[model samples]
Target: MAAPLFLLAPPRSYTSLVNAMLGQHPQCFGLPELCLFNVDTLVDLWRGSAAEISENGPMARHGLLRAVAEIYCGEQSTATVNMALRWASVREHWTTGQVFQEIVDKIHPLVAVEKSPSYTISVKRMRAMLDTFPDARFLHLVRHPVAQAKSLLAINDGAFTIKVNAFEIGEDYALMEPQIAWHDINLNILDFLDKVPPAQQMRMRGEDIMAQPEQRLAEIARWAGLRDDAEAVDQMMHPERSPFACFGPINALFGNDPNFLAGPTFRPHTPKIPPLSKPVPWRDDGKGLHPEVVQLANEFGYV
Candidate 1:
């Protein structure tokens, strides 16, 4: 079986768009956010895990439910989602790793490309991915800290930051700070990636891919031992063609970002990268990125 390709990055880091685009490669199967590593067994997905983070809601299960429905039943619908429930019930005791492998096996010969930003919250979840697929390839997707932080705040007033416990605790109050999650989650990914073999890992800035997708996409496809010819690269350039690029059935509405889902199609354009030294637009206090955030962004090729 071809090992799966995992996108490791914080939320709002272009993961949904990139994952969908990669899945459009003729030899790859782009899957919705099958957040399998967030728990132990199939049943644990429903039981939910106790942790400081809290995005594991019904929406968290949408990806797996939709995946099973589409992979096994050949569609994502109210009926198929229910079928997926029964499917899970039969294998409820199986480890989440085992369940994920089954889905990957079902789509054999096509590389499974997936991204679940929640996995960045805990190194244990990432380690589980390696434990399941020892030869798995990881793509550490990064965005500019300033750009990413602003996006985080723009969406739901940066509510997702609360899910990661990203806060600035002042002497008198605690305020939601998107950059905290940006810094820490990236740190989590870097720390966990240290355990992965250099040969099995690759890093690329989200801006580069957005700006020059054809060239950069070809680079990654070549590295993954996939076809990088014009035809293949052209296919990858149209992420909207992927089956899971849009909303699923009403029962399984979102396995990806809602914003991306609203407009999953990719256009050739460079994303603006904000300067790390400037005060972030989201903050009223006129504060710039933390020193550590800037240092790490520099290492990621941001200035």
Candidate 2:
């Protein structure tokens, strides 16, 4: 089986766009966030882990259900999704790695490309992926801490940060800090990537890709041993062409970001890079990124 490509990043790091774009390649199959690695066994996804902050709900299962439906039944209708649920139920006793290997095998030669930002919450989750597919390649997608933190707060008041226990405990209350999430999650990815061969892992700035997608996309295609011809480049430009780009059926309405689902089309525009020293706008007291965040961002080649 051809090992899949996994995009590792914290939420709000342009992972959805990049994952879909790469998946759009003629030789690849983009999948929604299966989130399988977050657990040890397939049933653990339903049983839930000890992390209280982690996202859990029927909705969390929707992505896997939708992907299974689309891959096996060639569609994502409610009926197909129900079939997917049944399919998952049949394999509930299997390890997550086993279930994931099945999906990769079913979609062999297409180069399955996937990203589940939640995987960055812990190094163990990522290690689970490597354990499953030793040959899997990793893309460590980075965004400026300032921009990433801002985007995180904008989404459900940084619920993801809380999920990852990115907080500042005070005498009176605990405050959610997106920058902590930004630094810690990237650290987790970096620590995990340390175990991967340099040739099997790569790092790219999300801003760079936004500014020059054609060049960057082609570079990634070449790195993945995929065709970098004009045709492949053109295909990568249209992430909306991916089956999981949009919302799924009413039952499985989201296997991806809702904001992305609302508008999955690729629009070329350079994302603004904020100065690390400036005060963050989200804070009432006008605080800037944490010192640790700045240091890690610099390590990531950010100014």
Backbone clashes in model 2, listed as residue pairs:
none
lDDT against true structure, model 1: 0.89
Clashing pairs in 1: none
State residue 282's C-alpha deviation in candidate 1, in Å.
1.8
Q: Model 1 segments beyond 4 Å from truth?
A: 49-54
Tens-digit lDDT track of model 1 for 1-303:
999999999988999999999999999999999888998888877875434223566788889899899888887889999999899999999999999999989999999999999899999999999999999999999999888887888876777898778999999988788889999999999999999999899999999999999999999998888999999999998888777778999988888898988898888888877677888777789888889998999999988
Candidate 1's error at 158, in angstroms? 1.8
Model 1 TM-score is 0.96
Error of 2 at 115 (Å): 0.4
- What TM-score does each of the candidates earn? 0.96, 0.96
Give the Cα error of residue 205 in candidate 2, in Å.
0.5
Candidate 2 structure quality by residue, lDDT tens digits, 132-178: 99999999999998888889988877778777778888799777888
